[model samples]
Target chain A: MTKKQIQEKIAFTVLTMTMFMVVIPTLLIIGYIIYKGIGTISWEFITAMPRKGMREGGILPAIVGTIYLVMGTIILALPLGVGSAIYLTEYAKQGKVTRLIRLAIMNLAGVPSVVYGLFGLGLFVYFLNIGTSILAGALTLACLILPVVITASEEALKSVPQSYREASLALGATKLQTIQKVVLPFAMPGILTGAILGIGRAAGETAPILLTVAAFFLPRLPKSIFDQAMALPYHLYIISTQVPNMPQGIQYGTALTLLGLVSIFFMLATVIRIKFKMANRA
Target chain B: MSKISVKDLNLFYGDFQALKNITLNIEEKKVTALIGPSGCGKSTFLRSLNRMNDLIDGVKIKGDLKLEEQDIYQKDVDVVALRRRVGMVFQKPNPFPKSIYENVAYGPRRYGIKTRKQLDEIVEKSLKKAALWEEVKDRLSKSALGLSGGQQQRLCIARALAMEPEVLLMDEPTSALDPIATAKIEELIVELKKEYTIVIVTHSMQQAARISDETAFFLMGEVVEVDTTQKIFTKPRDKRTEDYVTGRFG
Candidate 1:
């Protein structure tokens, strides 16, 4: 065979191997979780309180708490993050101040989740005196996801052509007007995807919530924002490690449940992205 | 009456002067064509009309430019309001990623025309003036990006017309489109001049000759000639202008 044919064979072989390595493991993990978790999924399991052993008891409070936390984080983070991104991309001049601000945000995303947890505990719980409440933890997670949301949204907004801004400006639209009417609607899908991804990451987080309001394993429902809550990841951690003599089956179930929730969040984000793409194509 | 007048207009980007000291009168409700080689500053001059170049960083200007007999570079002049009277269509068709209806209604809505009836009327009338309403009437809900290149170009024109500006500036709009689209846009220009003062910058000599009522030829940041289209194309003028017009050297 010629040298070109041998090189082509090597390239294809490498590409195939890489694809399989990534795909097989992902499918295997998802398959294992579904196989184990499907059995544990019941109306009672989803709605029942944590009265008995975690295996027999339902995950009702944890499910509700997770949803509440995700909602609060989204409500708290989206506007602030997207607004800052808009200022950086559209309004801010490219100079020392902007560059410094950008660098700080990039570093914020890199800080360990545990550090964010500590910061949240000190700032929200201690200083602000919110004190071991769901609101406190939700606020913390908002900060944790803020940098990701801002950076992703900035990238999305920047992808829109500058000519669109020029067109709006030339047509007598004010800077604020141009952004609101033209630039934003165009960048909405991408910005939403970023927020969704941030929400997913915030939903799956264990360490940050563990040090905050998620440290509790309350047997009853949270009455208000100040009430302590048990999240899915923390429930998984308590079931698998903290609880006494937990069954192997229960640990696997907990793992499967945690994975299921994160996967659902991810799938929802993907569905939203795909819907936008389909509509854009149509 | 002259709608826009420029006097001793000079602009520099950092240190390199993009436009020379130029003075001219643009009459109201007439089609003016600016023709030049690449980087001859015709587009710059065009952009300076509405302070569109103000968005660029480090662009310095020393000149007196008047619109409707008011000095545009006046310190207290509202740039946004000034721009409302002068609408620009770019060299390439850049439609906002929105439905055709929303794209046309954006300008009116921004200026507080919130009544659904009023906005609908504006969209319909503007699209009709652009001669694009029939083509897009059936698919107003579709994304502007879904349209063909020619259709998108016309949609852009309709969008600008919706703003009800006094002057329309087009910077080589047909350069990015096919021959058929170019012809349609050229025809639209002739129809537009009846109500709005229209100025277009183009690289096509034939296009300048065919559609323009008045043509201004630029060379090395200077206006070499400006006169009726017939005179610029047929009669002998300056040596450089005549040679360049004859395709000797662009």
Candidate 2:
């Protein structure tokens, strides 16, 4: 009833509310993902190619397509992404161009996935004439992931101590030699981690693929860069929305399969992190 | 007649001059000590010997830095080769996060020294020169980062020595070390001077008085005086040097 007691009560009430507000939503989202996604899990659901409207429909082609996408995307994105990151972090001075490029990448990450999808559809499919295929989807996905790849890679390279560079140079190594010998190895783990995250983002991407590569259905696996492909998310959307005789288990299976794929990518990331930490400790 | 001649040198880190017009002749195969307060540019001047200031983003230099009468900053000079001839040891021990053997091999490897036996010999010689051989000899494959702080710094010194540079620069090499490590490093410095031209910057007046044949005193970027270590410490030519040596002011 006293003022001091009232203040204490209000402080406690706000603290409790704040904690619950953060904790409850995070727990609920994680719980919901597991609850809705844990069922329909099996190797059969993930490794076999999708068969629309069937309980046994597998995401084999979609899985293969995703892997192909990751490969092509990494090959295309890693060089440019890491190279630009190195240039920015190591060589480039903090000037207008560097500042502008950083600001642009930040804005790009913030842009909606649907917006990225439309741009991919326009740039990769329509303009580049790659057509509706794995390559186009990958090119699009690579573009989608480039900003994150560059930012993380730049941070990683920057994380290397200036003393390392100085020590290398003092050893009579040239500037480029110092970076190649000392800076690059130290930053390698960070770049790998960034790459793994980029791959995950690229793999889990559904909206962009829908517009660029997954717009049309292919009963069979894509035969070439010009051929249409099946993606798990698109397959899930199609089976759940378009197919009349689609089995109930197919949607759950596809969702669970997609969840597993993303988790695999994350596990790979964790493994790489451990490798870097161990290397540093050693 | 000395191995290194620095004449009328001034250094500025973007208009804030760090070293005044300073001149000193460093004898070959002899140890020279540069003693000064923090921010007095002893370290800055030491870096100039190897052109290490080029690493600073916007450092400016105006002076004659000559190694045996050859101008160091001339347009024709290769900074890399110059650095190879003049190795530097930093204040804090900074060893590469690599194997003990690889740390020593880094310079020679960069300069195109290949073959396992050759690198092993250099590593062995350099480690022995640095007084680090007995401890690290058996486990050359171990990471340099695993060494204790003092050991790491000595490994860094060994890494620098592996190149077999003509002139060795030590910028407060023992500042980060405890007394035992400092004593070992100081002793090593004195011993190394028998074959190498050594220039060391130290804050400890007693260190300079004990280890150096010749000493230079700096204050606020100016070379206050240059004389024999005994003279600088006991009977300095400049009042400021006398004040600094007597702990009147930094």
Candidate 3:
């Protein structure tokens, strides 16, 4: 073969190798977790409360707490993020103020998740006097994911073809009507994708919950939004690092549970996104 | 009788002048075709008629433009109401990603026609008017995107028709279609003119000659001539119009 053809073949091999590099590591991490933690996953482990400093028994409270936090975050963030995105994409003029707002949102996305935990502790937990509770934790997590949702939702909204908006307007539909009927329907799948990303982040994050609401040893379920609760990430953190001579199996099992919970959320979001996508195409 | 009138109207996009001193009369129940090369503002003029240009940023309009003796550019003209009275079809077929029935029913539904029976009747009537009912009546519930390009364009026309507008603006409505589809749309436009005031922009001079009652030649953001389609196509007026019609230059 000519030198040029040999060079091309070498480039293709290198590129393929790098692509596998990404996939292999991801599979290894998941496979390792499942292998180590699968033995601990049982009916009692999932349904029963932990015993003896979380060294034995199930992580029921952590599981429930993470669910509440995720639901609350979604409730608070989805509408706000989607609304801000709509305003940014459809109504905001290309001006200095709008540009500034956009810049701020981008920067907000880059701010570390720990900063969001601190902000939540300052605003929702202390200043509001709501104390460390599910409300505060959810609010913190929502803030952490707001930038993701807004940016993703804005992209989704913008990806809708401009012709749809023009057609709706020319047919005498008001601006709001056009957005509601034509724009939003087409953008729903994209918006749900953003929500899915936010869910995974919120469920996996320990820092935000650490400052806002995570209880070190809460063994019971939260009675209301005002109650502090144990979450999987924080539970795993404490079990892995804080407890004396913690069982390695329980530590891996907790990590596995968190991973599983986040995966379930991803699956739910994918189902919703597929439904919207089907509706749009049909 | 004039259905819409424009006198010394100018439109600007930021620093660029897109339409300048455009004066013309669109007669009631007649086809008025604006023919010009690309970027000569033929499409801009059509958009200005119904204030669809308002959607663009930094667009400025000056001078008088009216519909049925009412100043459509007045501050309180209610653009939504004006648009309902003057619907539009685009150069490309832009049927919403929805069912054929929903695409036609969308406009009337937005206008507060809520009853299922009422929507069904309007959808059927509009589709029939656009000459798409025979082909698509059985598949009204199917996605509009499933239709051919020609059918999609006709669906857009039906969508506009559902609004029950007195005036219709078509911007090269057949530009994206095959010759057969173009012929179909041309025939529909000719038939539609008997009832509605039709203002169309076309690159095809033959299309203008074939279907237009009044033909206006636009050049460099100005109208070079406006006259009976027969007079403009044959007798000639300005040297520029003659040259353009005779294929000497664009």
The CA root-mean-square deviation of candidate 2, after full C-alpha superposition on the true structure, stands at 2.7
Where model 3 places Cα greater than 4 Å from the true spot, the runs are none
Each model's DockQ score: 0.65, 0.72, 0.93
Give one digit per residue, the lDDT tens place, for model 1 in B21-70. Answer: 87878888888899989999999999999899999989998989999778
Candidate 2, residues A56-112, lDDT tens digits: the string is 556678766666777777888898899999899888877899899999999988888
Please identify model 2 stretches exceeding 4 Å from their true place: A1-39, A52-56
Candidate 3 clashing pairs, residues 3+ apart or interchain:
none
Off by over 4 Å in 1: A53-55, A270-282
TM-score, predicted candidate 1 vs. hidden true structure: 0.95
TM-score of chain B of each: 0.98, 0.97, 0.99
| Displacement of the residue A217 alpha carbon in candidate 3, Å | 0.9
lDDT of 2 by residue, B115-169 (tens): 9999989999999999999999898999998898789889999999999999999
Report residue B188 deviation for candidate 3 (angstroms).
0.7
Ranking by TM-score: 3, 1, 2
Give the top-scoring candidate (DockQ): 3
Identify the leading candidate in terms of TM-score: 3
The models' CA-based lDDT, in order, is 0.86, 0.85, 0.95
